[model samples]
Every structure is written in structure tokens, then in C-alpha cells.
Target: MHLLEGVAAILVSVCIYAWAYGKHHGPGAPGWAKGQLFASLISVLLVALFPVGAGFVALGLTEAMTPASWAGLVALAVLPVAIWKAVPRLARRA
Candidate 1:
């Protein structure tokens, strides 16, 4: 169960981070990118901190799930992919 929770949490976190990365750094993102990013961060934090929060509740059922730790793992999983996808486009603009 612990392992499943960890995996689910990681997957969810990665998806959220990827969405945020695309929204902020992708081409033609809105002018309010900072606001959107802030909101996303807050949402992630809430999930990590509140067990009853949607993210927490979803991840809690899986194995090896701990709110803060899983969040970090998810970030680790997503950041590289997001950067890989975004950096090339950004460079072309440069």
C-alpha cells in the first residue's frame, strides 16, 4: 500500500507540475503567468499539508505516501521533463 501511495502521489505531483510549467513557460502563456504559478504552488502546498485535501486524500490511499515527501518526489519526476520540453522552444525564441 505504501508503495502504491508513493507512486500515485508522485504521478499526480508530476502532472500538476507539468501543467504549471507549460502554463508559465510555454509559448504564448498568459500575461498573468506569475499569478497562475503562485496559485499552483499554493494548491500543491495545500495538498502536501492537508490530509483531507483532494490531493492528500487521493494520495493517502496509495502505498508509501507521505504528504511532503511525495510532493518532493513528484517535483523531481516532473521538473526534468518540463524543462526538456520548454527549453528548446524558449531557445528558438532567443
Candidate 2:
């Protein structure tokens, strides 16, 4: 059950991150979105794997992260603006 929950959390987090990335980057989003999703997924997975990390994440959530997560959630909430800002710079160098 614990393993299942961990897997579910990883899946959910990846999906959320990918959805945010896609919304920001649009249908034509670059590989960087995937990279960010992967990075987020790895971070969560690492937390799940390490009991200490999991405790810290839980504590952080209870204290600092609740607010920070809201900010991140808001940032993700406005992904289109981020995409608009990022795509041009990405295009310029390429």
C-alpha cells in the first residue's frame, strides 16, 4: 500500500508538472518542459525513497511549503505568460 501510494504520488506530481509545462509552453513547447517535469519527478521520488527527506517534505509542507506551494501553484496557474516570456528567448538562440 505504501509503495502504491508512493507510485501514485510520483505519477500525480509528474502529471501536474507536465500539464503546467504544456500550458505554459503551448502545444509547441520545447524539450525543456519535459526536463523540468523529469526533474520534479526525480525530486519527489528521492523524497519518497528517503525517510528523512519525506519527513522534511512533510514538515516543509506543514510549515513553509504550504505557502510556497501556493506561490508555485499560482506561477503554474499563469503558465501562458511564462511561455510567452520563455519561447522568444529560446527561439532567438536557436
Candidate 3:
């Protein structure tokens, strides 16, 4: 079940990321927007690791992760949104 869930998360995340990239990363997009899009892609990719790791741990291939690790993963998942909002403002001031 964990493995299946992890697979689903990966599939969904990748599909969404790919759609967003295609929509927002056209030639006319600003450098800041492209940068943010890539940043969000990285953030979401890292976020997807949590489920994969969980699946691994469930299968006893690895030990459980620390609470801080889990918290950090959650933080990374949210970081993209923060970057998305902050980068434009910073670019304008530059």
C-alpha cells in the first residue's frame, strides 16, 4: 500500500509539474518566472521523496527517518510557494 501510494504521488506530482512548466515556461516568459518555475519543480521533486522514503522504510530496506527530516521535507514542499511569491518582488527591486 505504501509503495502504491508513493507511486501515485510521484505520478501526480510529475504530471502537475510538467503541465505547469509547459504552460508558464514559454519563450516570452521572464527570467524570474522561469527561475521560479525551476525552483518550484525542484521543491516538488524533493517533496515527492518523502513518500518514496516512507515506502522504503515500510519495506525495511532503511530505518525510519527523524522527525526533523520529516519536518524539513514538509518545509521544502512549501518553499516553492514562498519562492514563487518572493522572487518577483525581489526581481522588481533589482
lDDT of each: 0.54, 0.48, 0.52
Candidate 2 lDDT tens digits, 1-94: 2333333343344444445545445666567644767657656755555554334335444554455566544544454565556545543422
Give one digit per residue, the lDDT tens place, for model 1 in 5-44. Answer: 4444554454555565666665776677658667777576
lDDT comparing candidate 1 with the true structure: 0.54
Q: Between the candidate structures 1 and 2, which one is better when assessed by lDDT?
A: 1
Q: Could you tell me the lDDT of residue 31 within candidate 1?
A: 74
Can you give the TM-score per candidate against the true fold? 0.41, 0.31, 0.36
**Which candidate has the highest lDDT of all?**
1
Measured by TM-score, how close is model 2 to the native structure? 0.31
Clashes of 3: 0
lDDT of 2 at 83: 51
After superposition, which runs of candidate 3 have C-alpha atoms over 4 Å from their true positions?
28-32, 37-47, 50-94
Estimate, for each residue in 1-94, the C-alpha lDDT of model 3 and write its tens digit.
3333444454445444554455455556556656776678657775866567456435532335566446545544665575566445433422
Local lDDT at 2 for model 3: 36
Indicate whether candidate 1 or candidate 3 has the larger TM-score: 1
